[model samples]
Target chain A: MKFTILGTGSATPITERRPSAALLDLGNESILLDCGEGTQFQMLKYKVRFSRIKYILITHLHGDHFFGLIALLNTLNNTGRTEPLVLIGPHGLQDIIGVQLRYSLSFLNYTIDYRTTNPGAFEEVFSNEKISISTIPLKHRIPCTGYLISEKPALRKILAERLPPDFPLPYFKMLKEGLDVEHEGKIYANAEYTLAPASPKKVAYCSDTIFDLGIASYVYQADLLYHESTFTKELSARAQMTFHSTAEQAASIAKAAQVKQLIIGHFSSRYKDTSAFLTEAREIFQNTYLSEEGKTFRV
Target chain B: MKFTILGTGSATPITERRPSAALLDLGNESILLDCGEGTQFQMLKYKVRFSRIKYILITHLHGDHFFGLIALLNTLNNTGRTEPLVLIGPHGLQDIIGVQLRYSLSFLNYTIDYRTTNPGAFEEVFSNEKISISTIPLKHRIPCTGYLISEKPALRKILAERLPPDFPLPYFKMLKEGLDVEHEGKIYANAEYTLAPASPKKVAYCSDTIFDLGIASYVYQADLLYHESTFTKELSARAQMTFHSTAEQAASIAKAAQVKQLIIGHFSSRYKDTSAFLTEAREIFQNTYLSEEGKTFRV
Candidate 1:
C-alpha cells in the first residue's frame, strides 16, 4: 500500500502549506481522505487519476476537511465520468453538497453513495473482498471520526517451480486454500506445495482531535498511523483549548498504540518551520516522520 | 482602476489553467469577481490584501464561478476579521453559503450582507462613494448576470500654483467643487482655478454566457471588457450548443459595444495553446488581449 499527503495545514490559510487531504492507494483500489480546499488541484499536481478514486472518507465538515468535495464532484461531472463514487463522512455533509448542487442546477453524471458516520463509537463502515474499513471515534470540538483501513491477507502462493508437471488446476485452488489434496492415492501436503500468505496491513488516520487515550486502542498495532500535531509543546494549552493535539501528545499516543510508524501533520499556521514538530515527536516515537505534501509513504 | 485576472479556464478542469476569478482595485476599495475554486490560494499568490476586499460579485452559481466563496469566507473568519462583507450574486448564493456555514456549526466573525441580482434586466446592485456597480444580464444555461463597475469621477483638481496667495479656506473647498470665487468685485473664473475632473473609468465582465447582442448596450463604452471566449470560430457550433461563446463572437460583441479594449478568457480545456484565441479575437477587435492568470490590466 502507498499513502500520499496532499495537504498538511489546518483551518487557517497558510501560503506554504495547503489544507488537510491525503491519498491512499491499496493496489486495486484508491481512497481519498479529508478532501480540503484546493484538493482537486493538488490531485492534478500529483497526477492522481481522478476516475480511479472509488471511495472518499471525510473526518468532519470543517472547511479544512471537506470543502473541496463539491468542486471535485463538479469536475468529475464535467469530465463525463460514469462510475459511481462512494462518500463516507459525518452527518450534514450530504446537505451541504446537496444545497450547492441544487442551486447550481447541476446533476452528477455518475452516481454518488453517501454514508453518514456515527460519532462517539467505533463501528465498521465499509467492507469489500480486499479490504475492510472502520471508524476510530475521536474527540473534537465537532463530531469527527478517523478511519482505519486494513488490507485482507491474500491467498497463499503456490510453489509453481516445485509442482509436478501437469498439476491439476483443481488441486492448485485447493493448495492456495492451504488444504492437503490426495490425487491418485498420492498425498500432496499443503505446506510443501504453497508458501505462507503475507500478513494483513493496517493504516489509521487521526486528525483534528485532542489527545484522547481511548483512541490508542482502536489504532493499536497499526502498520502506519497519521495523527494531527497542530501545535508544539509550547502551545499545549492552546492546543487543548482548540481540541487539537501537540507533537508530544501525538507521539505519546503513537508510542502507547505501538504503531510501527507515525506520521504527524495538520500543522498550525503559526509555525513557519515544522522541523521542531519532527524533533519533538521523535523523542517519544523513534519511527516518527513529518507529513510533507506530495510525499508518498509506503506501508 | 486596476484589474487582476486570477483564473481564465472554464468549467472544465485544466492542469495548465485555473477557473474564472478576477480582482478589481478601485483605488480606496477593491472588489473580487467570480471567485472560482482555488481563488484563496491565488489571492495569496498574488499578495491581494484580503482586508481591502469589501465587495464580491459572483456572475453565476456555476461551480467554476463561485465555488471558492465559502472557503474564502471561512478563512476570513479564521483570521479574525471583524469587517462586514458584501456579497452580490444570484438568488441562491446566500442559501448555498448559509447551509455550508450552518452544517460546519461556524459563524462568521464578520457580518455578510447578500445582494441578489435580477436577471434579464440591467439594474444597479451596489453603490458607494468610491464606485457604483450594476448588472449586465447575460444569456447562459443558468440564471447569470455580468458586472459593470464604474469608479465615481474624482473632484476637480485645483490649480494651487495659480491660486491667489492666502485664498480663503472656505473658498478652497468651493474651488475644488468647480465654483469660482468673487473677491472685492473681481471675478475669478472657475475654469482658471480648477481643471475638469477626469472621466469615470468603467469595466465590464461577462463570463459563462452565450453570444447575446442584447448585452451590448449595458456594457457599451466600457474602458475594458472581459468576455468569455470558450472556443474559436472553428468550434462555434459546439460553443453555441454549450451556451458558450466563440472568440470571434466575443470580439463582435466588443466591437458592437464600442469598448475601448477587449479581453477574451474562460478558454475551453480542449485548447492547449491559447494563442489561437487571441489571434481569432484580434481579427475583429484590434485592441483585444487574452486574459492571463496573475496579469493585471489598467483602465
Candidate 2:
C-alpha cells in the first residue's frame, strides 16, 4: 500500500502551503481522505486519476477538510465518470453537498452512496473484500472522526518446488488454508508445502484533534499513523485552546501506540518553516517523518 | 481603472489553465468578479490585498463561477476582517452560502449584505460615490446576470495659472463645478479657468453565456468588455448547443456595441492553444485581446 500527501496546511490560507488532503492507494482500490479547498487542483497537479478513486473519507466539515468535495464531484460528472462512488463523512455533509447541487441544477452521472460516521465511538463504517474501515473518535471544537484503514490478510503461498509434479487443483485450496490434504492415500502436510501469510497492514489518520491519550488504543500497532501537529511545543498552550495538537503530543501518541511509522502534518500558517516540527517529533519517536505535499509514502 | 484577469479557463478542470474569475481595481475601491474554484489562491499569487476587496459580483451559480466564494469569505473571517462586505448575485446564493456556514458552525466577524439580482431585466444593483454597478441580463443554461461597472465622472481640473492670484477660497468649489463666478463685478468664464472632466470609464463582464445580440446595448460604448469565448468558429455548432459563444460571435457583439477594447476568455478545456481564438476574434474586431491569467489591463 502507498499514500500520497496532497496538502498539509490547516485552516488559514497560506501562500507557501495548501490545505489538508491525502490519497491512499491500496492494491485493489484507491481512497481520498480530507479534501480541502484546492484538493482538485492538487490532484490535477499531481496527476491523480479521478476515476480510480472509489471512496472518499472526510474527517470533518471544516472548510479546510471538505470544501473541495462538491467541485470534485461536479468535475467527475462533467468528465463522464459512470462508476459508483462512496462518500463517508460526519452528519451535515450530505446536506451541504445536496444544497449546492440543487441550487446549481447539477446532477451526477454516477451513483454516490453517502455514509454518515459516528463521532462518539469507534465503529466499523465500511468493509469490502480487500479492506475494512473504522472510525477513531477524536476531540475537537466540533464533531470530528478519524479513520483506520486495514488491508485484509491474504492466503498463504504454495511452494511449487516442494509440491508434487501433478498436484491436483482441488488440494491447492486446502494447502493455502493451512489444512493437510490426503490425495491418493498420501498425506501432504500444509506447513511443508505452504508459506505463512503476511500480516495485515493498517493505516490510521487522526487530524484536527487535541492531545488525547484515549485514542492511542484505537490506533495501536498501526503500520502507519498520520497525526496533525498544527503547532510546536513552544505554543502548546495555544494548541490546547484551539483543540489542536503539537508535534510533541503527536509523537507521544505514536510512541504509546507502538506504530511502525508516524507522519505529522497540518502545520499552522504561523510557521514559516516546518523543520522545527520534525525536530521535535523525532525526539520522541525515531520513525517520525513530516508530511510533504505531493510526496508519497510506502507501507 | 485597472482590471486583473485571475482565471481564464472554462468549467472543465485543466492543468494548463484555471476556471473563471477576475479582479477590478477602481481608484478608491476594488471589487472581485466571478470567483471560481481556486480564485483565492490566484489572488494570493497575484498579490491582491484581501482587505481592499469591498464588493464581490457573481455572474451565476455555476460551479466554475462562484464555488470559491465561501472559502474566500471563511478565509477573510479567519484572518480577522471586521469591515462589512457586499455580495451581489442571483437569488439562491445567500442560501447556498448560509447552509455551508451553518454546517461548519462558522460565522464571519464582518457583516455580509447580500443583493439578489433579476436575470430577466437590466437594473442597477450597487451604487457608491466611486462607481455604480448594473446588471447586464445574459442568456445561459441557468439564471445568470453579467455586471457593468462604471466610474462616476471626476470633478473638472482647475487651471490655477488662469485664475486671479487672490482667488476667493469659497469660489474654488464653483470653479471645480465649472460654474462662472463674478468677483468684484468681473465675470470669470468657467471654460477659461476649468478643463472638461474626463468621460466616465465603463467595464462590462459577460461570462458563461450564449451569443445573444440583446446584451450589446447594455454594454455599448464600454471602455473594456470581457466576454466569454469558449470555442472557435470551427466549433460554432457545439458552442451554440452548449449555450456558449464562439470567438467570432463575441467579436461581433463587441463590434456592434462599439466597445473600445474586447477581452475574450473562459476558453474551453478542449482548446490547447488560444491563438486561434484571438485570430478569429480580431478578424471582426481589431481591438480584441485574449485574457491571460495574472495579466492586468487598463481602462
Candidate 3:
C-alpha cells in the first residue's frame, strides 16, 4: 500500500502550501481523502490520474476539506468517465453538492454513488475483496470521522514454473486455497508446491481530530498512521479551543496506540518553520515523520 | 484605465488555460469582472492586492463566470479584511452564496454590499466622481449583463513648475479646478498657468453574452472592448444554442460599435490553437486582438 500527501496545510490558503488532501493507493484501488479547494490542480501537478480514483472520503463539511469536490466531479464528467464513483461522507454532503450543481445547471455525464457515513460512531463503512475500510469517531468542531483502511489477507501463492505444462486451471484454485489437488490420479499436496503469502498491511488515517485516547483502540497496532497536528505544544489551549491537535498531542496518541509509524501534518499557517513540529513529535514517538506535500510512503 | 486578463478559456477547465475572469484597474480602485474558479489563486499569482478590489461584477450565473466569488470572499475575510465589498450580479447570486456559507457555518468577517442587476435592460448601477458603471442587456442561457465602464471627464491639470515660490497651498485646489485665482492683487488666469488634462478613457466588458446588435449603442466609441468569442464561425450554430458568440460575431459587434480596439477571448477548449480566433476576428475589425492571460492592456 502507498500513501501520497497531496496537501498538508490548514484552512488558510497559501502559495507554498495547499489545504487538506491525500491519496491512498492500495494496489487494486485509489482513494482520495479530504479534497480541498485546489485538490484537482494538486492532482494534476502530481500526475495523479483522475480516473483511477474510485472512492472519495470526506471528513466534514468545512470548505477547506471538501470545496474542490464539485470541480473534481465536473472535470471527471467532462473527461468522459463512466465508471461508478463512490463518495462516503457525513450527512448533508449530498444536499450541498446537489444545491450547487442545480444552481449552476450542471448535469454530470457520469454516475455518482453516494454513501452517507454515520458521524456519531465508529463503524465499518466499506469493504471489498481486497481491502476493508472502517471509520473512527473523532472529536471535532463539526461532525467528522477518520478512516481505517486495511488490506485483506492474500491467498496462498502458486508455483506455476514448477507445475507441469497445460495443468488444469481448476487445480490451481485448490492449491491457492491451501488444499490438496488430485488430477487424473496425480495427488499434489498444497505445502509441496505453494508458499505462504505475505501478511496484509494495515493503515489508519486519523485526520482533523483532537487528542482523544478513547478512540486509540480502533487505530492500535496500525502499520502506518496519519494524524493531523495543526499546532505546537505551546498552543495547546488554542488547539483545544479549535478542536484540533498539537504535534505533541498527536505523537502521544500514536505512542499510546503503539502504531508502527506516525505521519503528522495539517500545519497552521501561523507557523513558518515546521522543524519544531517534527522535533516535538519525535520526542514522544520516535517513528514520527512530517507529511510533506507530494511525498509518498509505502507500507 | 487598465484591463488585465486573468483567464480567457471557455466552458471547460484546462491546465494551460483558465476560464473567464478579468481585472479592471481604474487607478485608485480595482474591479473584478467574471470570477471563474481558481480566480483567487490567479489574483494571488499576479500579485493583485485583494484589499484594493472594492467592486466585483459578475456577468452571469454560469459556473465559469462566478464560481470563485464565495471562496475569494471567504479568503478575504480569513485574511482579516473588514472593508465592505460590493458584489453586483443577478437576483439569485446572493442566495447562492448565502446558502453555501450557511451550510458550511462560515460567516464572513467583513461586510458585503450586494447589488443585483436587472436582466435584459441597460441600467446605470454605479457611479462615483471618477467613473460611471452601467449594465448593458445581453442574451444568454441565464440572466446576464455586460458592463460599460466609462471614466469621468478629467479634472484640471496642475502646473507645479509654474507655481510661484511659497505660493498659498489653498489656492492650488482652485487652480486644479480651472478657476482663476485672485490673491494679493495678482490676477492668476487658469488658462495661462496650467495645460489641459488628458482625455479620460472608456472600456466595455462583454462577458458570456450571445451575438446581439443591441449592445452596440452601449459600447459605441469605446476606447477598448472585451467580447466573448467561445467558438469560431464554423460553430456559430452551436454557439447560439449555448448562448455564446463566435469570433466573427464579436468582430462584427466591434465593427458596428466603432470601438477603437476589440479584445476577444473565452475561446472553446476544443481548439488547441487560438491563432484562428485572431485571424477570423481581424478580418472584420482591423483593431482586434486576442486576450492572453496576465496581459495588461492600457485604454
- Model 2 TM-score? 0.96
Model 2 lDDT at residue B3: 93
Interface RMSD of 1: 1.0
Every model's TM-score: 0.95, 0.96, 0.86
DockQ score for model 2:
0.77
Report clash pairs, candidate 3. Answer: none
Candidate 3 residue runs with Cα over 4 Å from true position:
A159-194, B128-130, B152-200, B232-241, B271-273
Question: Per-residue lDDT for A1-299 in model 2, tens only?
Answer: 89899999999887878899999998556899999987889999998888889999999989999888888999999989999999999999998888888888898889999999999889999998789999999999888999999888788899978877898998999898889999888999888888988898999999889999887899999999999999999999999999999999999999999999999999999999999999999999989999999999998
* TM-score-better candidate, 2 vs 3: 2
Q: Rank the candidates by lDDT, best first.
A: 2, 1, 3
Better of 1 and 3 by lDDT: 1
Local accuracy by lDDT, each model? 0.91, 0.92, 0.87
Worst lDDT 10-window in candidate 2 chain B: B22-31
> Could you say which candidate leads in DockQ?
2
lDDT of 1 at B76: 82
Candidate 1 - CAPRI tier? medium
Residue A271 Cα positional deviation in candidate 1, in Å, after optimal superposition: 1.9
User: What TM-score is obtained for chain B in each of the predicted models?
Assistant: 0.96, 0.97, 0.91
Q: How many residue pairs clash in each candidate?
A: 0, 0, 0
